[model samples]
Target chain A: MATIKDVAKLAGVSASTASRALHDSNMISEATKERVRKAMAELDYSPNYAAQNLVNRKTNTVGIVLPVRENQDSLGNNPFFMQIIQGISSICSENDYMVSLATGRSNEELQKNVQTLIRSGNIDKLIFLYSKKGDPIFDYVKQQKVSCVVVGQAYDALTDHIQYVDNNNFQAGYDAAVFLGQKGYHNIVYAYTDLEELVQAERYEGYQSYIKQQGLRDHHLGLSRVDNRANLEKLQSFLAKNPEIEAFIACDDIQAIRLQRLFKEADIANNRYALLGFNNSLITEIANPSLTSVDIFPQELGEEAANLLLKKILQESQTLIIPHQIIERESTASIK
Target chain B: MATIKDVAKLAGVSASTASRALHDSNMISEATKERVRKAMAELDYSPNYAAQNLVNRKTNTVGIVLPVRENQDSLGNNPFFMQIIQGISSICSENDYMVSLATGRSNEELQKNVQTLIRSGNIDKLIFLYSKKGDPIFDYVKQQKVSCVVVGQAYDALTDHIQYVDNNNFQAGYDAAVFLGQKGYHNIVYAYTDLEELVQAERYEGYQSYIKQQGLRDHHLGLSRVDNRANLEKLQSFLAKNPEIEAFIACDDIQAIRLQRLFKEADIANNRYALLGFNNSLITEIANPSLTSVDIFPQELGEEAANLLLKKILQESQTLIIPHQIIERESTASIK
Candidate 1:
């Protein structure tokens, strides 16, 4: 609530000198700078965002779009998105940038709301969450030329080349297959969500290559998602018909959790089958046998994505790729 | 991006009429309102919060002070908070309000924040998530005479005074006990979060009253939380100490999921040691032994709380104590 003038008066310095010291510009003496800072802190002075933004022509604020559903990712259940956002927020906060969340479930509605913010010239940059194929939002964002970075893989061709942060998903999939094969868990079933997603395609290829290398090729691949209970039930029916399936590789942790729950209902527990999942979500920790899944470092992802967006607004750089790691839990075990 | 004048010219109405229509004031004719709305839609006119707020002397926005880590309640895991927020947001968007989130973990900091917001006159009213025992946030709110509605329970001192929404905590605990008892499960274990909280205290009291009334004297209460993994380990130790415990009632779904994981590790599936959890969160659907828990109708809570806050802000009288219900899931019984 305190103004710059309040600090200046308290520090016995002119308002201009106080502001210069606060901005850390104009080469103020160390003693003067410290005095100004002490006065500012005592008076609870905060620099004005609105006024400062006009001179820089950038707000250092990143606008983020998420699904309106609170359970879109389940807050604690999947810390991937939340953690990424946290990372982005931390980076921005450190650089004095603010993050605002804008949400709508439908793509059309989401686009309109984002356009409102875009046209308002409120945010200098944007970080998008969706990676759905043929994303209309991405297309619109490209047209607007708002410095942008995507958390997911790029969906389509656009005016501006979008920088993104993603794991080496194909390599991860390939490695999962190799690990399962090394454990002597043959007759593996690679069940996943939409196979069209680039991440899924890479993982499936990895699974296939591993099977081909093992000379135990005639295995099954079940495709379904935990997000859709009906599709999961359908996938369960398919799995029931295929008795050759022993080990499983799920595209994501949520899918693995649902599959495990279904398997349990069919009287299958750990030791009967090995299960490996991705995203290393909270599901991995809570699921019976504690699922072993890949940790994509969501919080780091968010932080990186946010920083990338900030750099774009600052006219710095546009590209970055964070690393990924695997966490071992009870779900997958050496074939015993 | 279009102004009121642009909308007015397109709608063939005066600028004053357009403003009145946008504000939803009683002055505008129905035909005029329809025409202005059509123009606004065509022009992509997103309403201005600050300008309208200046004229109306109201922010229309209500602040929801949340704990820094909000994954505690079912609202954290379930899309419940999102659903509630969406419901409130729908009304706010239609009515033109900007919702701001503030952190409210420590009482001193919370008091400082509430005071700052009030002194700055940023928001129209406050909607508190949990009205714990004489929380400092409430104390400051009362001191400021700021309009507020407590989403959870209010103590006896503020019961007839402050507007609040109360969940049937006592009923939920009583029903849970009765349900377990009827299913031929006695010598139950009442596992709860720290009952220093009013809501928790009420729930515990309800459970105790039920046991006393039914003459079922073989139950013990224990403090078990999932905020940390060590507490979960402590819960495992508690279960080991009292091997005779047939069923455990968890206060929160996260706690139940943690309990479920511990049970799995200890090889105690639903058949032998049944567990009934509270706050029918998303954990129930995905947790290994889906939880049977209470539903506090979070969306309704948000709506009712927002409506009450608005009423108070407008100097309109409103009352509280909305109802709650129980939702049964697999954690309870697959009994004949």
Candidate 2:
């Protein structure tokens, strides 16, 4: 209800001087800034981010688009997203910025939302959680040449560079397999999801590479795609077929928890088949016997992503990796 | 960057006609509305929420103040808030709106952010998650006659005109005691948060009332103060002094889980102690023997809160109460 003129009158300064002090623009004296700040606080003066964005071409709001399909694949019930978001939010809130969420079903819908935000001049920066090859979302980002940072890999088809942070899933998978081998569990299996997603594929490859490295190239690889009912059944079938398989490594913790349920149904004794899970979500700790899990530091990953985006927005131009810790709990104990 | 004029030109209509069609103004026909919609899809037109908001004096953005304290309430460990937020987002997204998070050390900072958004004219509604006696955050809502739906209750001094969706904490506490009593437990203890929080105090009353009704009015009560450490120590002291207190009811799952850990350290087996927890959060399920807890449906509560806020925003004015469910897990068992 109060205007800049009222604030200036209350602060005993010219309207132009008050405006400059409020904006902290060039040439505003510190004394004037303090006077203006106190007056603004008294009057509850709030700046319109949208109007300011129109004038100065900055919104100071980041758009986070989480595209949830029919299944909400890789997302629904995943604690990982929450931690990453907390990380991003913690930094954003500290820096006096706000986060907005957008959802889409189809590529067309995703493109519509992104384009609408750009054309309507709502958010200046966008952070996408999911990435795809030849994504239409990327097409518009490239055309507008707006700032963006993605959690997943961007397509090589576009020349627009994006800052990203990802765990070394391949290396993690390799290390899990190698550790099991050193523990004398030769017939190890990799329980995975999708098998199409880049992260899953990389981990699968890592398991294969590690097996070859350990001269156990004859190992049987077990595949169980999560979300598919048949995949849950395949886990049970795999157990029935492979008595020699003493250790199993899951691509992620959710899948590992599911397998633990099946193992209980089979009445399999603990350590009869060692289990290792990834991402170290609460599921690992909740599994009846607890679970050995790879800690991806999702919270740190989220923080790094936010910092990366902020750096890019500020033109600092930095990129880096976040380390992972292997938390050995009850699930991956040595087989007697 | 296509405007209504471009859409009108492409559709062979006047600019005024396009505007009427987009707004569904009576001046336009249904056929024209369909044509304009198709054109909008092709050109990716997004009816500017801000411009509309400025004209109508309502942005439809709801502020959810988290009350993240200076000490930071260790909420990072649980997935409860995350699920609630996602549920809130789902409803907001469906109604074409955005949810912004607000957290501050003191109520002054909280009021500052709210005032900022209020002045920016960016949000038309508020949903305060945490409320304390004489809370400054609720002061703005009352002083400004703002349309707000608080998630929890504030001080009795605060105006009661503002709507809220608070859990029946008193009922939850009564049910915990009743359930434990039915199981043949004689000396049950009540463990909870600070009495300064009106909701927790209600729960304590519920426990006391239930015990009085059962003719066991001398039950032990342990109040876990604000800091988790303080609560832990209080719980430790309760265990040290009361050996006859064979059963305990924790106000929340987090507290119950911590109590279980303490019991383990004390060489007292869980289920041996008959622990019951409120808010069937992930921690309860993940704890040893799985905690028996009351499912408050935090996500559903969030959805309910958002629905109520939007209803008030649209002048629909309907107040509702969402129920709590009791989940009987392994933390407590029947003595019979």
Candidate 3:
């Protein structure tokens, strides 16, 4: 229950000096800060952050909003978000800032959660883990005029008004095809679900363009998100009719694994075809053949997004692109 | 900025009534609450939570502390924490609470991070994701008199003093061994790392007890956490020397997958032995022969922990045991 004044008196420093030392201000010498800290610790003086926030008009907390997904399992199963969160949390902790996670099972719930967070004035900045066209959460945050950063692509209309960090998904897709081609996979197919997400669309576009430029036949296979039986039949039929296809590039690692499982169920020999995936998640390394994946460096994406939002010069909209790499593994090793 | 008073005046209510409505107090009638909400929305009034928190002496935030590990990749690679966080976040969002993550790469760093979280007076409660004997973080939280719930087993000395939610790990191990025996496997070996964690020890104990009670020969393998080369060789030699062993029970899914990978490198046929793992993580399904694992239900553990901490009765120390299930898959199918 000791106050800053008491700590200052005990440390033989002025109250203002104690306060500055508590904030780790450059104006306060390390020796004085150490003395004040020792005195505070000795007196069991816990600083009231709520009161400090009121006075400074700062919360020293960042809000991380996860996207609302229809399949809630994605949130739990995907390690990409976890890695990004680790990156963000590490940086935030280093800077002495707390992280507040906002999540919900539905869009309305997510919006309400975010509204409550922003309205409560508990977070000074917001970071959206995913972005999409005409997202209500994005619109709401923008209307509230809260400083925020998006970790994925911003819509064309709002790109000028938002700061974002992303990988070049189109280029990532193109690079995947090029890598597979170099690995001697001539007839490569692109397989994805019906989610119609921005990243998938962009990547598919890149793949399509690469195929057309190479004068090769471009094959696309769409799988249902919910109906695994139909997907199995679809994959089986696709393989049956296209015996010449050498590889299939999935939109992400999860899809890649799903396809790999389907291939096994359909009695397809592992060496007959190659598989490539994105996001370079842990699953890629655990998959039977140890999948070849595009390492999107999700952690770096998170760190850069946090840095952009926390940067003092927040007036201008900034875009940061984290590079992606092709990690060759056993799944693609058969082709070589 | 619009104030509560302004919204109250616009809604034809007293400031106290408006405050109660904002907080959704049962004292305020539904009609009045709706009117106040409408007026506040019209006036674009955002409540100052810091001031409110100062008056209420509550931050409405829970701090989640992740265990410090020697390998940082474990934090990112493992999906257990992610699922647990999802469960915790779902319940927290429902009750209008924010989650703050405290992470560190080392014990000292974690202690400092946790100390800052507690001393900053920013969180009303703490949840430790893992429990260890003589953990400084746990000791610090205990000393600070902070309400906390541990998601893993508490040490013998602190069991009566602390609340915890954990699966009956000892029973889980016994059940795993029983499960393998029921699948017609006579010789089973328990494989684990050298970390000396409580859960592993308990599981191994159960396995050991089951083997003794059933009059079966017991086998045990200790793998290094860091040295994969040594582990690969050890596993190879163990398999070579013990051709009678029909199954290997891994402490968790990660180790199970590691063993599977090593078996492949050692040129062991997939059908030669059954692999059983705990945690039933995504990796179990993705592994080539799909590992059979014990579903410890990490998310449920998280939910139970949060419920215990947030329960109104804070005086009594309580322990909640989440049930575990054995999910049968391909890895064990060959033995059957």
Candidate 4:
């Protein structure tokens, strides 16, 4: 007889995700759930829902802990977190689970809200919509021994106990550089929103590693603030310094589109440079040449995070790595 | 010895919103709440919390009902609703109220979810993020006599009962046309996403009214679908058919950005056409010439909607018209 472990192995996911998928939990994505179902069918495995329900005693509600940024209004400014929330909502809707946002303007307020949510039995599991160093929330969750998942690259030192879902950003960055190279761009400028963001740093390292391997020249650019003034000045300086730069690999699509606009204003011919970005957002499609970008599939990441957290709640814990893809558009279609 | 109704009038909100604001309810925005408090103080009135609490029987939580669209993934695709959500979140956070989202892929599912949310006591009041005629959800809410507020213009028939918050889109559209005319663009194209959207229809009417009054030629264009193929084809046809068209008054910023891209690809010179849009989104900031657009103040609308809903919940209701502002940029700076 094929056991649940065999099915999990076939699906290539954590035993927890596989178990949640089999139970049609709201935390798993349709794609992951379909894969688990296919694996179960092949292995002839059937889960006992009645017995699992008796053991579960689940609240069917998940708490989303949004990050507290310096600006305090980051949620309204960045579409990244909103996209993740949509993804989480999709999966939760399917599984008949409710996702409530628990956020505050400051760390103290956020900690208080989280503690209250957990103590009051409002949420069965918690999903941190961000991963960063010195996040006090993580320590509190750990101390409380609460079931939780972080939706970004996990902290290296705490990887053993913390469950997380993240894209292989390093590989994604390396692949972006390789794509640019294949299009005959030798001098590449790496543009980033912030060096402190975990994904940006990882992607930047991967980009550096790729350029070094290919013996290509590197031009680093930073958009350290959302104010746009610093970013615009940096762009002008970079262009003045590196007139021979053939392509730009922005950390994300928003900045890439902004760069495209700046390039136009600075009288840089569109045909002279290829712009590649991450997070193939709507902005990419609306760009003049339609920007080429890496698709990190935030929806899938949200699904995986929710799934991992649910599994942890059920005493089935595991980390998951979501995959990414590169989308080719007119921005990188032709060499100058 | 002033009444709550007087405070509502002074605050330029409905009676329910005024009451909620005075009570420090979660459904009122900070701005409106402050205004209501000021109005109360000026009127030399102090509310009795015990009596109001007994009369209100408030749960202090509000439900946000998102529209079901033909494209079920509209929530992820459009930043419009996301902005409104952020606005609602800000106000709800200030008032110490929990905001819960109720959405479904179809009308039936949406109605069912709304009913369940209300019946189960997960939400105390409701706010609809979008409004159009013949929304079954509206009918259901009315039948159940559920307290609610719509974020856009209320339907003519339902105006008596339904409270709402909307911009003066008509005057805004007329102003946009007049602005383009001042820039020496006589032949103007009035563009829209879909005629069915309430805002689109109102803005289009405003555009028509402006052209007719000025005795200038008016060209009508529609992006019937967001798929881009039909939109691109329509753009090509519009350009070829009306070579005399000098300026475009797009219904919203997203469509305006898309039109700019389409024009660029179709071999239209950047300076040949004056482009103006509504809702000064980030896309406006990143456009080649930085798009000229109307600032609808979505955050304020969200705040107003929450305020109205709380008022409706407390049986103190009235319609509110939030104002709009025009922001000029390089896109319509001068005619070539």
Candidate 5:
């Protein structure tokens, strides 16, 4: 809470001299600078960054823009976002950059808050948690020439301008099918939610390519738009018709966990089907029998996004693809 | 991105007049105010709040101070913290206040960041997620006379000035024991972590009180400082010594989930021991038999904290205790 006057008085210098010394102006002599530094340190003075930002136009902070969730009740409750924040915060801490989160119950509100944050010059860069088409915030950031990076896969056409960090989701999907096929599972289903999500689409495409190349069949079960109970019933009927299905490639770990719970409720034997999930999140480990999942390395994705955004802020440009690995666990392991 | 000049030109007034109109100064006539409002709306001009804050000294933002974690890798990865944030964000959104997180890898770094944040005047209120003893940030906030509300139980003497929101943890603990005792599980264990944590301490006190009143023996297990494997081995050994123990009251859901996993790995039959956990978090649902946990209503806790902080900021003071409930699930259901 020490002011410039206090530092000046403590150092036996004028307020202007103290200010100059703090700002490292050439007008302040080395002795005066040393005295002012000692005085400020003694007083525990913290330079007001907001006041400095008015002249520098930089806040040394990154603004994290969260995607407007479909489930408003679960806002900030998603483990995926929590992991991304952990990655982002770790990197930001290392770089001495502060982080501020921008969220809203709706997209319009989210966009408005983002605009306010940007216009107020509270952040030097923006790291978006998702990259969806026709997003106003994305369009605004692009039009305003702001330094930004998206954590999800970007559209093919937009990738040239919008840099992003993501995993090879398509290859991950293909590998899931190949892994199951090698495990002696012939009929495999690609089960997922949020069919409109680009990651899900790409993963599904990978599943399609793999099934075709291997002379296998493809069955898509969409659960994104439906409620959990409805999705469970739909899954049950599908399994009844296609009892030959020996394995399923789920889009993410939560869905895979849900599928496992449903299987248990339906009295389906554990060895009857193998389930492969993505994200290798904690849920996979907590799920009974555990879960075999593709470790998309979400934290790495977040770290990559932060690194890319920092690069963009420094006038550098780069796109990054975080690697993914399959973690074979009880869900896909041979039952003893 | 629109400027005051643009609004002035569109409203047929000078920039000064436009600014006054925007500020709603009494010197500006109603007619001019109406014109400026229309121009601002037409151009989608947002007044710079940061500049206004320099005068009004309010940021309409809350600074959420997290406990400095020893586990640097899992920063912001705690699901319990995530749920609290969900609650905080929901209430903040409802009140049109922004949420910013302040955390660091070390206590010193955390204090520095908090000081900078406070000195920069970027937040009007601070909400601490924990109230452990000898917390430098807590001491600083108290010394600075800053508006704050703790989310956990504070020491009895400090509660006079520090408004807090918490459950009756003693009752919650007592209720856990009584719930198990009522179900014919006479010999029960109170399992917890971080006895230093006030919540855990209060819960343990409640458990002790219950055991004394019921004339049943009390056994305590501490796992906070130990690694999971070590804790599991210790638990296995404890169970070996006390095979008559019929139930466990884990301090939280994550611990409960871990206990369930350990029991399964150790080949302990589920029906042999009942388990009860706190927080009714997602892990409970994902656990094999589905855990029965105490629902402390984390979202409501967050809402209450925000409400209390707002009231304190507005010159009101009141301590609040949010209600807790027991959620019965397969983990505590009658043995089949």
Candidate 6:
């Protein structure tokens, strides 16, 4: 209930001095600032953020933009986003900054919402949860000259102009195939959804390169977002035609699980084919055979992104690659 | 970059009138507001939210409080919180209000952070993501008289004074028992963790009531948040002693999956016991044997809570009970 005037009187300083001290403005001497702080502590004064924001021209808030996924269900079902958010939220909380989410069902809506968020001056910085080439939101943020960070691979054109944190998804895919091959499973295939996404493209490229280097016949399976009847039939036909395929490397854990279900329906025994997935999420542990997955360290990616965005001067566009680790589980236990 | 003055000039009104019209203040005529809207559209003007907030004394932001769990990993592992947040985010975005997350590692830290959020005048409303009996955060928010809504059951003392949205957890528990009972499973046991939470306590009470009514010997299993060796040993012993228990109703899908893993290790056959869990989350679909779960409609709960908090007048302290349904899956398909 104590006002700035009261704090100023108790600290033996003018109201303006107390206000400046509250913000730790260099204009006020350290002695006066310390006196004002003690007075504030004695009176338990909590400065109004809105008022301070106006004075400092800073909101002390971060905006997190979630990609508008084609499959809306993925927005809720995917634990990857939540894990990254957890990492981001932890760092933001520690820094005394609040996090605000910006999401939409479509790109147009997402762009408009983000525009409004930035124009409103409610956020000091922004963190894009995903990255894609030629994203309008990315361009808009760049034009606005706002301090921002991306949590995935930036487009090649903007690589030197943007700050991003990502796992070496290419290496992850190559490693998955190599790990399975090391176990003597030479007939391995890559499974993915939405090859248009840079993540899928990069990972597939890595897998394809490995296959070519080893002189193995390369086979890949594409899946729809939803597990509809068409998808099941496709999986069944693929399995029937490629009976020699002994293992699969999926782009994500969810896809791995869905494929596992489809494989079961096709009457394929669990041990008949080994499976490896990415994003060692919770489902990996609960999965029927307990999935062998690549841990991309999503939380660390988020944390690094936040750290980059909060930097005082983002003079040099920095790219931090969080390492990925392959976790061996029951699904990949088959030894030759 | 057009200002209010430009809009006012184009609308043939004073700057003050244009500002009021922008807010759609009751004092402004509909004709004048329409004129100002046209001018704003023509100029592509965006109002600075901080300045507007100062004038309106409203932040147009919602604070979401996540419970401080003893097991920190649960904060990220459990999809329940993320689902709720997605629901809250969608609704808040629709209303053009930003959602801010308030989280901490301990009860004391959570309380302090929430207090700071409120006192900072940065949020127009607050939503507590979890409910616990006699929680200090609940008491503090109530004392502050902030427009707030709880996403779980209010304690008995505050039931009449708080607005809350929750599933009938007790009924969900009772229904789980009845669903299994109707399947001709006479011997049923309940599995849960941390009964101190009202959710666990209420569900257990319902399960216990059904067991006593049916003249069946009630058996229960308690597991820790993490799958530690101690927990595995405890589960092993419980299963060893309750070999005759035909069905198990778990408090959540995650716990059910954990139990399934433990049961597998103990050499219990999938067909040997019918397993049912709550919170029909993503894990249910991925779990081996797939879990039959009670869909508590978590997103709806979150949406309803946001709706209640954003209401113009929360005079009645409304309590909404979202209905729960049993989602049958492979885990509970056996008719024995």
- The candidate scoring highest on DockQ is 6
Worst 10 residues of 3 chain A by lDDT: A310-319
| Candidate 6 clashing pairs, residues 3+ apart or interchain | none
**lDDT for each residue of candidate 4 in A82-165, tens digit (9 for 90 to 100):** 677776766666665666677666787677567655543335578898877777877778777467778876675344577778
**Candidate 5 chain A least-lDDT 10 residues:** A310-319
1 or 5, greater by lDDT = 5
Q: Model 5 TM-score?
A: 0.83
**If ranked by TM-score, best first, what sequence of candidates would result?**
6, 3, 5, 1, 4, 2
Candidate 2 per-residue lDDT over residues A130-219, each given as its tens digit: 677776777678678577777765345246567766677778778888877777788888876567778777777888998887777444
Task: Superpose all Cα atoms of candidate 4 onto the true structure and report the RMSD in Å to 1 decimal.
Answer: 11.6
What is the C-alpha DockQ of each candidate? 0.26, 0.22, 0.48, 0.15, 0.36, 0.51
Report the TM-score of candidate 4, chain A only.
0.77
In candidate 5, the residue pairs with backbone N, CA or C atoms under 3 Å apart (3 or more residues apart, or in different chains) clash, namely: none
Local accuracy of candidate 2 as per-residue lDDT tens digits, B3-64: 88888887788888998998789888899888887887687667666666667766756767
Q: In CAPRI terms, where does candidate 6 land?
A: medium
Higher-ranked by DockQ: 1 or 5: 5
What are the candidates' interface root-mean-square deviations? 5.3, 4.4, 2.5, 8.6, 2.9, 2.5
What class would a CAPRI assessor give candidate 4's docking? incorrect
lDDT of 3 by residue, A1-336 (tens): 689899999999999999999989999999999999999989877676777878877777889999885654677777778888887877787777778888888998899789878877678699999988778888888888588888988675344567888999999999999988888888999998853677888899989889998999999899875566788799889878998999999999878877876786777765577899998776666566778999998878888888887765454546688999999888887464
Which 10 consecutive positions of candidate 6 chain A have the poorest summed lDDT? A310-319
* Ten-residue stretch with the least lDDT total in model 6 chain B: B310-319
Candidate 4 DockQ, CA atoms:
0.15
Q: Provide TM-scores for the models.
A: 0.81, 0.77, 0.88, 0.78, 0.83, 0.89
Each model's lDDT comes to: 0.66, 0.69, 0.83, 0.75, 0.78, 0.82
Better of 4 and 5 by lDDT: 5
